[model samples]
Target: MDEILDVVSLVLILIGALLCLTAAIGLVRFRDVPSRLHAATKPQVLGMILICLAIALSLRSWPVVAFLVPIVLIQLATAPLSAHMVGRQAYRNGTIDRASLHVDELAGSSETPPAAGG
Candidate 1:
């Protein structure tokens, strides 16, 4: 059982590391701001979750796991919100490529205030 737990932890840790690396590579490889933001946030969140899981499994401490739960929740809550804000800001500032977007609900929504004097 101990060996199994160790193996599981190692696997999770390795997978998390790979995800982080993939996110890093994507940040560099993706050209558009939205795409880069996707690359930066999505895998990073998953990686963090996986890493937290590995830590919980390895420590096998309920207190430590309890401490980590809120951290995981915070990451889950914030990462997407942060990515959306960044993506929206980039789109508004004309930093993102319009051609890359397939569906632009934001472009058609009243949520985006119109430009002054336009």
Candidate 2:
């Protein structure tokens, strides 16, 4: 049982490391903001979760799991949100190529506010 647990933990760690590496490569190779954001958030978050799981498994302690759970939850919540904000900002700034977007719902939305006393 202990040997199996160790093997599983090691495998999880290796897979997590590979996912992180892929995210890094995608960040460098992707030209567009949305694509980079996808690369930065999706796999990176999964990789972090896997790594944390591995750490908890190896440590085999309630305190470790208690610490890791919140870390995973926070990453799960924040990664996509931050990515969305960055991508939205990039689009608003006209840094992202419009042609790359298949459907831009935000296109019709106006950013400017109405005049106060008009």
For each candidate, what TM-score against the reference? 0.88, 0.92
Candidate with top TM-score is 2
Q: Give the per-residue lDDT of model 2 (tens digit) for 26-75.
A: 99999899889999998999999999999999989999999999999999
TM-score, prediction 2 = 0.92
lDDT of 1: 0.88
Candidate 2 lDDT? 0.90
Candidate 2 wrong stretches, greater than 4 Å = 110-118
Local distance difference test scores for all models: 0.88, 0.90
1-118, model 1: which lDDT tens digit per residue? 9999999999999999999999999999988887788888989889989999999999999999999999999998998899988888787777877777798777765345666443
Instruction: Give the range where candidate 2 is weakest over 10 consecutive residues by summed lDDT.
Output: 109-118
